[model samples]
Target chain A: MATTLHVTLAGNPNVGKSTLFNSMVSGKSRISNHPGITAESVDGFRDRDKDRLLVTDLPGTYSLHLDLPEAKLCRQHLDQDVEFAMLIIVIDAMGLRRNFQLFSELTQLEIPMAAVVTKSHEAQLRGYQIDLELLEEQLGIPVIGAAERSDVRSLEIDDLIDGARIPAQIPAQGQSIEQWGTDLLAKVSKPVHPEQARRRRLRDDRLDRLLIHPILGLTLFLVAMTLLFGSVFWIAQYPMEWIDALFGKLGVWISSRMDEGALRGLLVDGVIGGVSGTLVFLPQIVTLFFLVSLLEETGYMARAAFVADRWLRPFGLPGQAFVPLLSSHACAIPGILCSRLIPDRRDRLATILVAPFLSCSARLPVYILLVGILFPDRPIAAGAAFIGCYLLGAVAAVGTAGLVRRTLLPGRSLPMVLELPPYRIPSVKEALRIAFDRGMSFLTNAGTVILLICIALWWLSNYPSTPAGAEVTALRESAAMQSDPIEANSLLERARSLELRESAQASYAGRLGRWVEPVLAPVGADWQLSVAVLASFAAREVFVSSLNVMVGVGQDLEDPTSMARIRGSKRDDGSALLPPASAAGLLVFYVLAMQCLPTLAVTRKETGGLRWALLQLTWMTAVAWILGTATRSVMMAMGFSG
Target chain B: MSDFPIEDPQFWIVTLLSISAVILLLWSRNSSKKRDQGGSCGGCKPK
Candidate 1:
């Protein structure tokens, strides 16, 4: 029987402990330049010569003094986890003074440990050449040098594992942590090329002036974000279309092969449609993670956080919340996941809570539809309203974030103490691995739930069948007598339209729509619009299709005549289907509502509770309703006619 | 062939499979919920 060797990798934030752990176990824990991106502990195993090494990588922490989330988690693992056969103190050679304090604190645990110095090459280049043999002698434990920028496989990891022993001396207990760090720092940091060290510091300082400047830095950050998200949307477009077409063809093929029945319709429209709806967004998700991965690997992501911190701090969000908030513009699933970068539990939760308020790409089609209705003829005005929709969502996200921090969270954002990593040429291979891992993770978690929900919704919309009514029967009879084929086809289409309308009105989902109709009346909506609004909880983009179906419009949402048909329709009370005020209000609602089930699912998963997900839903829905109603009331008072 | 969908064997088979799929999903979700030690956004930050 092979014995198990319980090993752990521990370090300060940004010390590249994860990279070394990956090397040790050939594991794929996502690595980033941002501090504490590993918000959780994970284990990996390796087999060596009749023994199996179970390696746990603990979340990195800078201090035990603060009640920070990462620090608390790390403390719990070290104190309470299974007795370690070995603890690897992974410290950075480049910033030994800064990183060594955590090492000092861990010595109190008195576990068997060895030291591995990371960023060795970076230190040497800047003139600090750490002598591993001398330090190994001083600490009386095995030590090795590992450079993160190098091929980590070249590390003699097996030897390091075999050499683990309880150190003869722990970092001195009496002196302050900083003083101890500096005292040890003098013993090392031997000047190899002292002049180069000055030059290196000078270079970094000069770069920092522009990159993290208050005004210029923020501008650069925004520009970089625009380019990043722009590319995500633009580049993912082709693959998205391909996925759409592929699924469409698959549905058609399934429909042809299956026998005519409700089962076939369910498979084609419910199952396949649901899967495709989720899968079609995969390209956008992949692209967003890919570009962000590249930025993170290049080390600019840390700097970007610093640049955002100045503006975000006043709003009770840390700089780390910037990436997640901006990412929400693409999709809230990854945005909520990215909240792991944040250190405080409350700040992270607040970011996750308000992230869905931002208008994700899912809202774009709804915007184009409603904004088009609001300003039909004036192209410039339509374009401005489209831009205004995006701005409104952004304002809502920030405002909600501030409100949440003050009330539910009840604290200003913890002040940021940042350590900007030196920028490097990003590795495409590493970026691709990070992006792929995140993409697969998304598919496994959010996609499955979305598919199931879509199926359920599809079933709700179709079941308890409504038989053909009087108008539908009359139209069919008229079509039968028409002599010309074209005229016959027109009559058949009219009959189909009436049947759809009747069925939509009588279906369970339709009944739910009617149930909510009175509540939505103040927002300038009747039963049909209420049904669309209710169905959109599945996904905001579904609003356009749901409304179209409820009013008996054709499948082609982009068709001008279909849009015109929607505009020309009326309510049961004989009022216009969507007056100018109502359209404006609906636009506002789509911009602010928590309408994506996938996002809520991810929020629950990320926050580790159903309470947060429910809170996010309640708060955003209430905000959207109040604002939507306000918009309609103001517009109505302004005398906007149908 | 049966006149009604419910009477058809093939219809019943497909319906059974769909219902089973939903049950399996619920079962899987409940199982994972129990297994969760509860604090990771799926990895990278130390537990």
Candidate 2:
């Protein structure tokens, strides 16, 4: 029989539980849903001195009295019928009393657990004295102090593999019994969980002032947000450039080596170019995640949430909704997942309903393209416009949610009572580890999706035959005749004109675009632009690539001239079509549309019905159409011409 | 086929390498603060 020792790494959020888990189990991380919950569970393994130990990294929770899915799962996993040889409770050494609360609960759990005191090096620097033995005796569990350099983890697991049991649970502290259970039980249960006792003594008076004292808390909130922005902007440039260079070099190298053909185009222009364009942003994503993980790990996130509660209440959201909303800024998947924190079904629904408005990173490409084309010299204006769009989306989302609540579904706000976990210095190792993993996932997984889409778009745009092919070939040869002649270049460009060359009549995307043109005509859309908009319904970033392909131009998103050409093109009669008002209208249309397929997939799964997801699509699309038409009319009235 | 944006790819590569070093440095400083403050309560929750 294979003897496997089960060791659980537990701690409050931001206490470096995941880091220690990673240290124990290198390269075996798996994100799995818990046995019966929608929340994600991370599990892994490690080998110590020829013995195998299975490690489970439970979500961060303040106590066993869990209301949130993350906390509930943590508590549920602990009570599981499966036998565990030993439980290793990871405590942020800097947060002794607060960590002790959870430690006390674990003791009451009657599971064999030992305190693995983390951030030991910090204790030395801060001149904090720890009576290790006293802490061990007080909790009736073995206490081990370890920091980044400490490597006794393998040995500790070896001991567990050798059937080591956490010294028996120290009975609960007596002082806290009356508050939780009964005074009668308090007499017999001398020390109710020390955590309860600590919680009683923990002064919310000081924290409450800084956390909820509307004025100061809001200021601190602004400062934190500023720092986050600083990190995202200031720190990410080098890595972004590096990624760009890497992909550009790879594209150039591949294109050079391969014959000039469809395969080469697919590899260089489509795959490398598109994927690298997106993946370059991964460093920024990781940096954002790192800051958030650090804040969350060190316990400031809860306080931030707590502080923002009163302000968020009137908006039909609680303070906790802020984190998920903030997360939505990076991507909607995690934001949607984080909504599980909102216990009230109505609030969660509202959050889900409005979440798409948070301006996801996918929109970044489109935003960048538009900003570059229209506002190239004014980066600040571009950024301000970007922020304005986010604000607009948020405002719209809130208004729509309020409307939905009153008419479609109505419910009262869930009372806000959140645990304020004590602050601890976040483990840097843990932050980096999370940042690395999440960053890698974005690069490898999401990058692949974007890459495949780009390649498909490239293929569609460059495939099959047009009867004008002979004329185009002759033009190409004639252009080559005088390689350096400017007039020859213009003539070759004429060969690529949008003349009623008839070939586009058979191409798949063109046919589909035309088929949908009738439905879009009222909304001021031509078949080519309509196809781009429809493709964008799959993903906002796909808009540029799809449009680029539809126009038979390469995917050079930064090229203003290419966009101008597409914008300047006309119908067979040579009538002007992509007018200023209509172009701005289409831009506004995409701006308001909830057109991401992944978001829809996630919404369906999260809401547990296709009904809500379809409703989301219908409502958002309707909103987009109405708003787009109104905007176009307004712009036209303002003397904008097509 | 377009001319590379930077005058020297290697130079930019080295610059990125150095920037990564700087990031690691900053990350270490932050980690050290957490390490040094380890063990025993200072009466404040880990924020």
Candidate 3:
């Protein structure tokens, strides 16, 4: 029979506990639940000599007192009274004091255990002194230092497996161990019980002057945020452009080889043009997520949350909402997933409801397209406008969260009892893996949703034919533009005119747009714009194709000149709607809109009712309509007609 | 009555000055608070 040692891996959040699990068992288990639960129990098998050990990776938690879901799970798992050879408590060496709190409580469980101090390399560099034997004496457990570059601890763990047991009483010579353990607990005494461990580590009064000094700290935070946003946009732009060019060239090359047909059109426009156009933004997404992962891993993000907590409090949200909201910038899927950490149901719900407003990777394409259309000549200006839109999304999210909490789902702010894990230099490998996982998740999970929306939009704008004369004229112009290099303008114009003449009277999408046109007409949206808005309801990115279809651009897999036609298209009376300010408004609208059907579905699934999702849809749509109307009205008043 | 351009140099100078000032003030406040707490609790029994 195999030795079933029920070992639990417990540590503070982001203390390289997951990485250690990966290294130990060579497994990549997501180990999550749908409606969100504490760390779902994960089991891994490891064989040393003849004994096979079963290791369970418990969720990283601050303490074992049954506070959070994961902590409760950990406590419940231990209560089963299954005999464990040893409970291997892993602690970051630099964070020994904080790590010891949990360790001390675990010892109180009176389980046979051994301590493995991690990140010895960092401890050595930081000039932090820790005596392993002394700690062992203090905790009445065998203690060993572990480093990624070393395997001695693995050997120690294996050796201890057979012999490790909770001794009821030790020889009198081990009396010093009890004293040291008592002394360690005495070190953290403070007048106020809660937030003591955190405040002491931060040296609260000093940090508050710089971090929450009302005026100074707030100003610093704002400055830091502006720079963070500006840098993400400016620095990532070069790589983003290279990716765009690469995709564009590949698209052009692929289109050149195929004969005009539906298959060719689907291959070129639907899959490559639609999917890759969105996918080319992966590098930017990866970079942003990578930076976020690093910030989170390093513990500065906790400080940021602490700083923002006061501001966040007004929205009936805890400071813990900040990191999850910030994480949404990469994508809301993970952000919604991370909201599980917020223990309080109401806070988590509010956080999830508002999270999609933090412009995700899905909205990036819509923003880029609008920027390209509106400010073709000013790339830098367009980038700034894009950043501004992100800010708008964040502001809208926070503001709306406040309104919703007050009016609809009134709730109290959750208790803020987060543990601030000591700052450690983020492992590049760990950060990269996290970034890759997130980026790939977008392609796999969210990408499927996007593709379905695209195909549906393609069908919407394609069917219902024009009259024969108009169709012939459209085909001739498309072919002329494709064959001739310079007549692209005429071809594009012909396509646009054809769309204007026939779309509303013909295609299902066009008909739908015209039907809804009256509703949005007061908002200055034409039928074509109305069509785009309707498509955007499927997803924000669908707005581009909806527009492409409205222009009668060869959205058909057979139509090779579709893109060129789209570029040169104009509205009635030869006015371009793709100018900068208009694009900015569109970008703002997409950023603020609850436009993705899949996100709505997921929100409904997460909140367990249509009530929250319905509220989300109504609020986001109302806000988008108001903001878009105001933007267009103001621009028109400034004599800039769309 | 507004700085129209908000020159980059001026922005950086203001940012650095504000940040350093905040840090210094925070350090001082933290030191004082720590002292106050330490003094008050010095003679008290351990929990």
Candidate 4:
């Protein structure tokens, strides 16, 4: 039997821990460039002849004593009774003093360990050098320099294994850990030349002056975000149309092949239509994550957070909240998860509570639909409205955070202290990996949730078979009697649409919509829009699909004729189904509402209590309702009735 | 009321599939919840 050695790789954030892990593990584990990516301990094993080495990658933390979640997780793992063969402490060569602080604290455990100094190339470029042999002798361990090198196999494994098996000695106890780290760095690491260090600092300071300027930074941020959202809307449209057409053809083929029965309906309407509705948003999700990953890798994200910090502090949020809030634009789950990066409990909670207000990709479908209806011929106005939705959500988030801080969780935000990493050209490979991982995760996880909801909604709007009215029956009969094939087909299409409308109205969803119609009437919603909104409670993206199905659009939302028909749809009182005011109201409502059940579930889990989740849901929904009604009222007052 | 068709194979298939999908969804959600809670630093066991 082969001997199995368990080795733990620990490091502070952004110390090339992921790079070393990826190189050592042979692409077996997921890797990302940003800090806090390793949220859990992942185990990977390598077998070299008779020796099998098991490696565990723990979450990055500056110290085990910090009150942060990552710090606690590291402590838990370190305190476990299971003996490890070795602990490889990866550190950035440029920041040896800061990184050694963590090493000094780890010495208290008396664990067998070795140090791997990474990024030596960058450090040496800045006129700094390290005496590796002296450091090894001083620390009484095997210290290796692995700069810009990811291949662990090239290193002497036997030396590390032998070092691990040696008895560890505790450091002298007189000096504090910080003092000990400072003393050790003085002995083994040569200092950079004062002039060179000052020059580098000057370069960073000059860039910071521009990047963090109140007005300049905010302007750049807005321009960058506008381009991002604009690209998502414009570039993703082609693929989205293709997907929509594919699903529509699939449904038609399925319906044509299978007889007009329950199975066919279930397959065509429930399964295919429901899944395609959510999947069409994949292009936007992928593009957003890829671009964001590129920014994070290039070290711009930290700077952006720093810029946002000064602006966000008045709203009771730390600068660190900026990353999570920006991430919420992709999906609120990851955004909530990333809130772990915020150290303060109150700050983290406040950020999490308001994150969902940021317009996520799920709301894109709904926005595009309403914006299309509201401004059919005006592309520039439609684009501005799209941008306006995002800004509205952001303003709402800031206001909500301010309110929360002043009342329920009143406190001053902890000052932001962050290490701004050196900027480099981001690796395209890493960005692609992150994009692929995020896109697949969304499809597999959120896709399942959306699929099930679509099925349930489809079933709700289809069951208890309503008998067609006399008018519809007569229309169908007259269509059958038409001599011209094209004219007859058009009549048949209208008859089918009428039948679908009647069946939907007679179904359970329609009845529920009617019951809730009065409450929504003030917000400019009739029963059709009300039904869609009610169905959207499971997920906001479902609003578009549900409305299409209920209105007999049949999944081809790209068809201008069908879009015009849906826009021209009427309520019982001959009012437009989605008038300008109602469209605007729904847009505002979707922007503010906490309509994602999964987000609520994640909130409950992340906050470790149902109280916070319930409070978030109630508060966001109330805000949405009030604002939605206000928008409707203001629009009506402005005499813009459809 | 219309007669309920217990003998129909299509009916049984739809019921079975629907029940399975619901179970799968619930199972996925439960597992996801567990992963989120268990992996969270806040929810980690106090040392």
Candidate 5:
């Protein structure tokens, strides 16, 4: 067996500790400008010779005191067997005083330490020269200066592995920690050759002044968001149409080749049609995340959070909740996980409870499809509607947060203290990689979970076929007797349509839909729409695919006709299925409903009680239903037509 | 006239296999979720 050695990275928040960790070993720890993003300890490993080196990256903190939860977590993890471990203390070259303060606290542990100073290039540009040799001599430990984007191979970190040992004497023994930190920093840091170009790097730049302005900043943020959502819709349109057309062609080709039977029905409708509904949305997912990644890389997200802090306090939330809320736009799971960054229990739970109200990537297809149906020819209107959906979700989340904080968990949120990371050029390649990874994960899910669902739904809607009703039999007879070819073909088409409709009404899924139709009636959802809604309850992304299956199962998926067929579908009474009122109501419901089972499970675990989860589910459902019904009623009263 | 596909032995065999596969997928997911929750499924498990 090889010998194992453990090394831990410790540092003040935003001191580039996470960047250093990424340099040392390959890890997927989310790198962001937000302080304490490393809410939990993440581990990475490397092997050299016959020995294994394990590195743990702990949450960034200013002090290692036991009272601070982040510090406590670090201590507990370190206490688990620190006898075999060494510490790497990362310091920001530009802010050595506070870094030394944390360093002073860590020396109390009496563990072997190595100091790594990062952002040397940035600091150098600003005229500060950090003397690593002086630091090494003063602290009696291994010390190294590293540049931004340091590669472990070039950093020669392995060269310092053996040199990591207890310092000759720790600082702060003779003086207070703060005073000692100041004195020690003065000795090691000196001003030299400052450049005018880099002077803006130290202080807030002109861009920061405008970005944090109350009016201009908020307006800019909204404009940026609108463009983002607009692009998510418009940019993805071409690929979505291509996927739709491709599936339609495949379905037609398979239908023409295969003999008419259950197998052909299953393959054409269930497999091809079902998967295509989801696959079509891949471009949107990739585009959305890619744009978000690009934006985050530029470090503007922290400033946005800073601007939002003032407005958030009135809603019973701190600016810290903004990161999690923004994360929820991609998925609720990570958003809930990120709530751990909130210090107070009430605030954290409040954030977790309402986080799902933000429309995630899963809801994008549903919004796009409905918006397309609603505003067919106008891209700008569709974009605005897309923004409206996101805005609705945000409004609902914050409103609920206020209500919950006032009633169920009453408490004021902590004051916001945020660090704004320096802006830099965004990396397109890295953004593409993140987007590609997310898109592939979505594709895998569609192939497995969605494929199974589509197959099962097809079976449910296909099985226990009943004999054709009298009307279809009469229509078929009339078709057989017609002499003119065109007239006879038309009669046959009607007969086939009637027969299929009868079959759908009798199938198991149809029966289930009928059972729930009365409850859905208030929202203007008939049995067909009810089936689609129920199918998507556990996995909201399945809404479009399942609706494709439910709305017109056997329609030849031949581009224009199939989509037109769906949009022109009629109810049992021959009225238009999705009138403006019903469509609007359905959108509202989807935005508010707690329709994800996995989210509920996560909520159950995170809150550590079934009661909270149940409350969340019940509260969200009731709010959705009531709001949905009201929207439909109000739209109808205001004279919106089918 | 030939019998329907559902009446054929091959169709039944395929159906059985597909059902088993789905069941296995669900079971594995449940087991893994339990593992993720520290080897005890919360709610019903004793402290």
Candidate 6:
């Protein structure tokens, strides 16, 4: 007695399929700027006339016959034994011929269908008028013209739903699908006059000339990236500081309320410390995602990819590889997952193998820590050094890709071909939504993983607890005797710091670090650094917290004074713990090392074999160690002391 | 107060977190394997 209709919204990539889906469903589904952003079908429902119409947004694919995973997914969903009331194929009006080709193929399914032509406004702006009635007649289906507006409810989509209720008749045509598509286009659409066409072309060409020009485009790209990274460093500082202070206060509060015991140590030093280290990077992650979303929405990402393609092709990477590589800067998992869009298997593999070389947000805290130590007074130098690390990673990725292409996956690089979507002003609301989603997902997903690791590490370093020695007791006793309040507080702080450091040295992690010190010594790592590096294998950002735990600095690195104290920390031999050479070496190592277990698990799963993952780990670790050792030697030879 | 001195608040918190971590890890691994078997794009095929 209940009427529920199943409908699918399908279309070519970047033809406003997601936008229409969002508008129709009222932002019920995820929408982003890039083509193939939705790799899986998302379902939403609407109530119409006492009946429910369930709309499913399928992944964008160029053709049902294409071998790619997205194409197969589209085909699989379409072939599923569900009684569909209608299939509304969304097409871009500006690109009718190519879009119609898909519609012609869809006709073979023999399902009740309607066609919705989006981007009509863009077409009209270019002086072209599409006859939806003629298109309806030619295709024997209801054709609706939907302008690119935010309000999908205004587009009379209900008429489309109603029209789709009627089964479409497949017209018997002598021509093939391609010919039918061309014939239908010729009959139903008229292009702008020659002069008007020239004018539109001129406008597009003028913009393209600047955006895709060799020297100017590259320069603009560099400038844009510099500003982006600069803002990431500058803007994220405030929120990062707030988070650090909040966590610090929480730790102090807990310490005050609880008596000194294993429970107190675990709460203040283990749990809070670990969570704070990773959470502190949230502001930068949010900023990066927000800005990247804006760029993707503005249609600039396509042009930037186009430019990068020209430069990267000789390095054996196609332009299409640029998106995944760029996305890797956020996190390599999504970046590797996004590689499904690349048509060629070899190119995709190379992209996946080398993507982790890009310095992800996980590395941000480590970079800040070491850079802060290396450049205590020079913020400008620190910023430049930060940018330099990203560049180093990117260069290493491209170089590695080139080598792989030449040796293992030997083949000529595929020539890049891409469609540059019409430029539009980015929507702030959409960008903010995407940024929030990404930030939350990062916090929830990576946060859980990091939190567990942190607790485990805390337990590792805390248990088999060491008792306070004679010197620590003496310092506490002396602090109690000091009459001046300031002096007394300083002495108390000293006693606390001494006790923490002593306990840290006696911990299991400290013992392991001491065991591995000789092996890491040539790379300028002390026992503490060795412990931190070893612990960081679980996750790169863990290095900061592990180091904090090892050095008894507590968990708040956001405070300038705390960071300064960390920078001034010395080894047992009273030598500077992080000299410029050693810091540079560590930075290089972190940049190149395949230290993330999650990334390896993802790689093994993505590449469909542990072989590639093993190769990636072995190759990256070797490269990182060799390069790091060289950097240390070179810096030391140059007399660059801390 | 009670005979079970080690079963304090800190003990419970750490225990809860560790148990949650183990459950999450197992759930994630199982789900990832299922996704792979289902031919979802998220995971690689077993060679």
Docking class of 1: incorrect
Q: Which 10-residue span in candidate 1 chain A carries the lowest summed lDDT?
A: A553-562
Q: TM-score for all predictions?
A: 0.76, 0.70, 0.70, 0.82, 0.87, 0.82
TM-score of model 6 vs. true structure: 0.82
Residue A602 CA displacement from its true place in model 2, Å: 3.2
Q: Write the per-residue lDDT of candidate 6 for residues A63-131, one digit (tens) a residue.
A: 888888888888888898786457999888878878765676687788888888877866765667689
- What is each predicted model's overall lDDT from 0 to 1? 0.69, 0.59, 0.60, 0.71, 0.75, 0.73
- Give each prediction's DockQ, rounded to 2 decimals: 0.17, 0.02, 0.01, 0.17, 0.11, 0.15
Model 2 whole-model lDDT (C-alpha atoms): 0.59
Q: What is the lDDT of residue A427 in candidate 6?
A: 74
Model 6 pairs whose backbones collide: A605-B44
Clashing residue pairs for model 5:
none
Stretches of model 6 off by over 4 angstroms after superposition:
A1-9, A17-32, A36-59, A67-73, A83-86, A114-116, A121-163, A166-171, A175-200, A341-344, A372-383, A445-447, A469-496, A516-525, A548-579, B1-47
True contacts kept of 2: 0.00
Fnat values, one per model, are: 0.03, 0.00, 0.00, 0.07, 0.01, 0.07
TM-score, cand. 3 = 0.70
TM per candidate, chain B: 0.62, 0.57, 0.49, 0.63, 0.61, 0.59
Q: Candidate 3 — which pairs collide?
A: A206-B26, A206-B30, A261-A558, A265-A557, A265-A558, A266-A557, A373-A578, A374-A579, A374-A580
* Cα lDDT tens digits for candidate 4, A1-642: 888877788988767665666556644343444456555576776776767887778878888889888888788888876644678888777788778667767777777888787777557646677888888787777878865533343566557655752324434656565776778778987866858766876887787788778899788777776776666566666776677677767767786799876577667666776666566667766776677677776667777777778888999997778767766776677678778878789999999999889887678778877876787656556767888898999999999999999998899987767677666567677577667766775576435766766566665666545767787788889988999999988887777767776777677777788899998887778887788788776667777666655554222233322244357567756567888988888788888988887788779988999999999999998999899999988998999883
lDDT of 5: 0.75
Model 3 has an lDDT value of 0.60
Ranking by lDDT: 5, 6, 4, 1, 3, 2
Q: Sort by TM-score, best first.
A: 5, 6, 4, 1, 3, 2
Model 2 agreement with the true structure over A377-425: per-residue lDDT tens digits: 4544555555556666767777777787777768667656655554556
* 1 or 2, greater by lDDT: 1
For candidate 3 chain A, the 10 contiguous residues with the lowest summed lDDT are A30-39
